[model samples]
Target: MGKKYNRVLLKLSGEALLGEQGHGIDADILSTYAQEIKAVQEAGVEVSVVIGGGNIFRGVKGATQGMDRVQGDYMGMLATMINSMALQDALEQIEVQTRLMSAIRMEAIAEPYIRRRAVRHLEKGRVVIFGAGTGNPYFTTDTAGSLRAIEIEADVILKGTRVDGIFDSDPEKNKEAKKFDQITGDEVLKRRLSVMDLTAFTLCRENETPIIVFNMNKKGNLKRIVVDGEPVGTTVIWD
Candidate 1:
């Protein structure tokens, strides 16, 4: 089967890396994600990743505790860098060439984010991981993912979550919540489903970049969606 997308931006929550553990990254989860990513890449999909820092630290949580908002956000950015480095290591271990680019410019560990360089890396079939959350405070990694995806002209944004797809209500809490195989972005906004922050969703809506929310923990699902062109997730469209 032909691939569904030429390039995609994968947005993952840091908490997804926790697995059964309460804190930090689980080695098993990291390995599984790396393998899933490798499968898609090998199938000729240009992939870029943006992972959240919620598992390690959340700036909003810190701010609620009276910490300076900017300082807390910067710390959160560093936490994302930590997760990015781990994923980079895991991908490299599996012989997948990758480049870790940081928005905040930590020269010792990551190269500073440059749009041209990042696109070049993707063109060469290297998976690029974007870290540090837009190099600014007050923006979630979701916003960063949308920004990067549009910048690189990715065909879609693949949000890898624990859930099967977007639902009308919290599927974990509300057993009767309805699931939509496909929905318009306007409906997502009107219903206020938290697929992503408003800023991020608005970016995608304006740019016409489709978003697929799917279960990344399910082995082979990534390949099925990207390579086999299966409808394994809920697709958010602009129309």
Candidate 2:
């Protein structure tokens, strides 16, 4: 096997947490993720996580419904914190050391996010979950994941999605879509693929952080990528 990435930031969308349910957290899905993360940690990979809040609330959707944009965004952030807390509790149940940090000041629920402290927690083999997005309106959780990955100097971002990898088009909608084994950041931009938002994609590109888009629903995929160095997903890298 080839060398494995030492530290990685795993990005899980809020929708991922909703396994079979159309909305809300599904216990089975949460348990599966916690087990996967624990297996990866046992293999000596430092892990941190950032989860989105679209399952619970979407700021743009709220704005379309005539709600205040900023207020809706804040509510979205709070939703992420809720998801983070759920994830934290699940990981702990599996005996994985975990930390829940929030960008927003919610001292009672989570520790305020501090760059060095987060790194230290990772150093101590604790899985740090970053919640509340960027603590500011208008920035997506994808941006928060990118910012935290850069801050902690992660080797890659393991983007856990429903699909196996990034395709030329949405695989769900287009059965004929083509999948790329490996791709360049520039190509993704030129093709206008929706891997990440432009802001997060640019940040990863400029920083030379590789991103692996894989299906987390597949059991053992996480451990295979982090421990065995298996190319189980499409790797997006700087050319």
Candidate 3:
């Protein structure tokens, strides 16, 4: 099958790096992700990755427990940088050339984020990993992913979650929750579906960027969605 998306932004949760563990990165899962990403890269897809830091820290969660919002957010951003570094290492170990860019300007660990430079990296066939969650408090990695995807002019945002797709309700909490094969962006906003934060969702809606929420833990699913055009996820797009 022909490729459905030539270039894409992949949004991954920090918790996903844990694999079967409860905290931190799991070697096996990292290896699996590296392998899958390598396969997609070999298929001629340009990839930009944005990973969350929920497993290590979460600003909102910290605030609920009484931490200052800005300070908590900065810490959370650091967590994302840690995860990004781990992912970059894994990808490089598998022979996938990668560049880790940070919004927080850590020259020691990562290069400062520059839009044109990032796009150039992609053009050069290197996987670019974005870290530090927009370098701003009150914005999530989801928003960062959306913003970076738009900046890079990617075809779509592949939200790689543990769940197979978007559901009418929380599938883990309610077995009766039904999954949608496809849904309109307006409908998602109208129904208050939690596909992403309001800011991120609105950015995508206003920009006409489509999103695919799928189970990234599943082997071959990335190829199915990017190359084979299989309906493995709930697609959210302008109708």
Top-lDDT structure, candidate number = 1
Give the TM-score comparing model 3 with the true structure, all chains together: 0.95
- Per-residue CA lDDT of model 3 for 11-55, tens digit only, reads 999988887777778989888988889988988899999999987
Q: Model 3, residue 166: displacement in angstroms?
A: 0.6
The global C-alpha lDDT for each of the candidates, from Candidate 1 onward, is 0.94, 0.92, 0.92
| Worst window of 10 by summed lDDT in candidate 3 | 58-67
Tens digit of per-residue lDDT, candidate 1, span 180-199: 89999999989999999999
What's the TM-score of every candidate structure? Answer: 0.97, 0.96, 0.95
Better of 1 and 2 by TM-score: 1
Error of 2 at 109 (Å): 0.8
Clashing pairs in 2: none
**After superposition, which runs of candidate 1 have C-alpha atoms over 4 Å from their true positions?**
58-64
On a 0 to 1 TM-score scale, where does candidate 1 land against the true structure? 0.97
